[model samples]
Target: MFELSGQDVGEAQLLVDGSRLEALRGTRTCARWRWSPGFQAGETEFELRLPDGRTRRARIVTDADTRKLTRDDFDAMVRDILEDTFALFSLSPFRRAVSRGAGGPVPPIARLEFLRTRIGELEQVVARIRRAPRRRLRAEEAVLPWHKARHATGTEIVRSFRSGRVLRENHQPPRLPVQLRGHLPELIRVRRRTDTFDLPEHREMAACLRSWRDWLRAVSGRLSAASLPGSDGAAWAARLQALALRVERMRQEEPFAALPDAPATLTITSLFRNDPTYRDFHRLWRDMNLGIASVFGDFLAMPLSRTFELYELWCYLRLARAVADRWGVEGDGVSSLFGVDGAGLTIASSSLVLSAGGGWRLAFQPRYAEFWTRGDGRGSYSRPMTPDIALWRQVDGVPTPLVVLDAKYRVDQGLADALTSTHTYRDAIVDTKGGVVNSAVAEAYLLTPHQPAAGGQFETLPMPDRLFAPDYHRAFRFGALTLRPGMQAIEVAASLDAIASGLES
Candidate 1:
């Protein structure tokens, strides 16, 4: 909620994000307006319209509570959750699409930063591998003159004796073969130790390096295709081209050139396990294979203004974890959370459904449309309502919405306003049969970072002790749950358990 007042303005209207705000009181020159920014964070624009046809503009920077979680902490949490989500998506059909540039437009700053850092590390590793590549003494067969042959095995000598050719060159002094009176051959087959870099491990390393170079080139091409003139993306694409060129050059040099393609079956040697260079190479190669960073590059590019959306996603994942903890996930439940579309692979943000044991299922942003006149089903009595998270239970072959949780990235007074939606959700959403209407949702709650006694207007609603009390949920199905970043899994589970207990009552 925000308040704006201007001098010498008889009657003024306040607009936030281009939407006019209703004044709470005192409209002339000192009107107080209430507006909930919701999850929007960053610079917010405010425009005030005066009665005299004059306009005043102000920009205010809004941010989350630093005491709860900093921006860096928020970004890290988002990355971690996205990594987990990508891991789950890898098992679904969308994995192939994700590999084929499904991540949409490359985010300039985050993509460039990732490429820069990873390429730097790869350069160092390639240099080290080049300096000391794995090699072995391979026995090589060669035909040499008798005088030059240092060691010849009996089998080789016999083979050379059978296939030996006489040297026609005239020497000042007779060579060893001529002096031996035809017992020694002029040319002999010899076996010598030679350092060869054709080991299976080296082949595997070469394959990994080639894969990296190709992936970098592909990403660079994508950036170039989407880049505009003099844009940051164009600059990033240039930088990526340079990095890709460097990798290509490194891959073409020395041991990599001598190595064959990676075999269908390659053994993992002890050197790969213990050697520093080999271990680093293996680890980095595995990380690149996962494609967690590249596949979800758009996530890291998200702006702070969309922090609320990120928070909502994080909340859903955390809630799913809590639900899984309470009741084990059903078969392939985790993999079912993702779906593939023309946009590539993405979490089913609008209509994801996850099943668990005990006939429980969790849904993400399922809509309850108006179906009041229709027979027995779940829907809203008035307008369509969609909650961020909904918990359902299968009862008599029907999926019944038991709890609805709306994640609001607001605290204190903003949270209080958010709670009003819960009231509407609990009352308007209903189960109808033959024109009979009853509440479809047992409990509806606003999930926020608001803690009791945190010094805000929330004190007027409920204190910490009473708000979190299990009995409180039973008495009032509509309330608020404190869920913020950095909360332990156990703590989140406990908070969710409170909701379950309320439903049981």
Candidate 2:
């Protein structure tokens, strides 16, 4: 599978060194190797050229088990990767202490937290409504029998269809007795009411909670709808069922009935009327909508495998921890370095600044978007240039050198592209008001899954011992480092140790 020959059992010529060797179905030979084609990793198929101008298709398999993948394994890997990603930054030192909750996995607990938090907020609103049902004292005019009036004014006349008699009269032209038939403002107590609900907030809150509850039920019901994969399949299904039951209970305790037949405009301002409770209601509404959209709607359908795009995210998080540790910081210190930015799990373009003392700081930008490069020298962007990870720091608001790291999910045939792109990344120059400065892309690295050392062709790329030389004037180049997906954390830490130590020295 690692050769570039065309013949089934016979010999063929190599592309790189032009040597001849036997081509086997499941084995590799040095004479049949061509380093020029480069190595491709992961689940990709490529064709190898033959001396007779024919091509043979081959697939590169990295996982030991190439059989059908199970849903449980997929879910577990997703959860593991995401958990590691979130651990890169804690919300606050006392977030868990104060809120009785820590960060959660992107898909499962995080999504659940969103639901729980929104529900709690809605509950508070319900409490407020129950405490002070919105009401108003209004006025209306009506002709009533004078006896019903507690204190009626003078009446100008009282008639019995024959003759009129003054029940009470006053010398003042406008001042009549209590028996007067003149119109008067009657104060009426009007309690705000919808169907069984009073305020529009009540109706909207009920509708929102009902929708969320329905969504939860639907999701939970899906557990029995199909057979799930993984060892935790039954357990996960049970958990879902339990959550559904809880939601059912919550809905049963629903404070407000369904919305009225007539529509009501439920504005936060009208609901709380500048009351502090307005914040709670608005925040809950926003969170409920966003949580549903981001978690269940967006993230639920994502697949977990070597092919997932989040592989880069996982890599960046692990690398961040490794880099911090390599800088002589561990545990809380490492956590603080990245958390200084206060942004949480920004997958593509996350920026962080670490104060390293002595007027020095270390800044990192993962999936750095502002890194622009001109690949073909045409005075225009020949191709898009965004390094998977970029590291740099400024002292006293002035720009310094930068280091760019790229995560290559597969590096066999893609290794050449990674190398070429990384070099172009090296040439990226940034202009500042102080002056136009070369980004001084000091070092560039291509991180990929570890192929066995027996396959030596991938490791031949040039890497300097001193990646971040104190001199900072050396020409830039990329080094190929291997990572193990099965043991992601260990491999990532090991790779960063090698890369960061070189850079720091």
Candidate 3:
């Protein structure tokens, strides 16, 4: 059984001896099936490759207990979902997940005051020893301190307070991330949950929870991609995940009637229209702390994931637009490339950027669409790709420099920053590896954003009217910069140009 999920653009596969089995559809949601493979159980191998790049494998032994089912059952169940079943639709990866504005600089998870208190206790001992007094005694006094109370004995008279020191207690680093501990209890608890199918309530709650988990995971993957921008993007991803987990935890705790039936008549429209009646209706939603209905309820009724997905698309589009506006990559053309699901951004960056600048070729592990079935580059892309943005050089003899670049967006970056935050890192280029490490880059026009001139790979030289403004050089304003949004295109061209110059040098 192979479950094909993701934006309907990409596909997921399950293989048993490198072949597809179609009978697993019934178990897609809950694969509570007993397997008795004819091949001496140990001889048969089972493997699952999730939509994400994570893969798991196991083999069955014919002699072992036949009742137990591992992830293969789950994988087969998921594979069966491709049967075109259920009220399926793209749940946007960009939906205003949880209110990201709640927590301030304080980690929202747990407080660490106890550990701080222990460190303070150890410091007191050290302070007392340093303040100890030393008084010398007369040699004629009794040898032992017990013999002389009034007269000082040599041994009892006085001594420096520096005999020894004891080791101080040091606490272990907390496992709780600045924001993850709160969700940890709930997320871990649901892992081995049993389905009380016999109960009407557990059945409904479990179903909803499972769907919610898959939906959250998909969107989470999108934000962590190269183009989208957000503060603490990864942290927010976790927080959103925490939100999903909370939903499941709610279901797990009560299993049924998790939310009091405040209002059976749900109207998504009221949220957008400022309807006072709808706003006051659902206390369950309010109790759960989801105020978003007031702002986006109308959109929620329409498949929350798809709207969120579009938001992510918009974010990338905005980013690409900024890049284009910055570098004037139009002459280069913008074509999309879809690469392996978990392959680094270099794959797509290599595919699209190189072709924009002409003959500077770039190759990548092809895909129908890397991020999702609906992101800008979806299934519309060609796999085992031909030149995505085929190039033809402007100058006849200028040899193009064929360079490949990658976009690195760390997950935690989302955890710490906001969507519009600047892209600067305090890290200096102390460890410059091979290649010319630039601490700064400047063009005639605007300076790069959030970084010094030396923004790597992403920096676009200030292009004149072609991109920025008509009188580009005259309007040049230097300042802190990050990689040029449009630099991928220019980089393709500049790298080739640099190669040409190097050849002539």
Best by lDDT: 1
Per-residue CA lDDT of candidate 2, range 70-105, in tens?
222333334444444345444224242111112232
Model 3 score (lDDT): 0.28
Lowest summed lDDT over 10 consecutive residues: which window, candidate 3? 82-91
Ranking by TM-score: 1, 2, 3
Total backbone collisions for each predicted model: 0, 13, 49
Candidate that would win on TM-score: 1
Give the local distance difference test score of model 2: 0.44
CA deviation > 4 Å runs, candidate 2: 1-80, 97-218, 222-301, 326-384, 395-399, 429-437, 452-476, 488-491, 502-505
Error of model 2, residue 488, in angstroms: 7.0
* TM-scores, each model vs. reference: 0.54, 0.38, 0.21
CA lDDT scores, all candidates in order: 0.66, 0.44, 0.28
lDDT of model 2 at position 157: 18
Clashes of 1: 0
Candidate rank order under lDDT: 1, 2, 3
Model 1, residue 446: what's the lDDT?
A: 79
Candidate 3 local lDDT, 1-505, one digit each (tens): 2344344313344544333334344333332222434212223456565555776776544442232222222212122221101101111122222221222222111111111122233234323322431122323312222212334322322231123222222335654334333222211111122333233322433454344444445444553452235344454454455545654444444323343333222345533136333233232222222221111111112221122222222222333333333334433244333221221111122333323232333223122232124332212222222211111233364422221111212122221232222112111111122334332112211122122232222234342112222222224311111222223434534433422332222
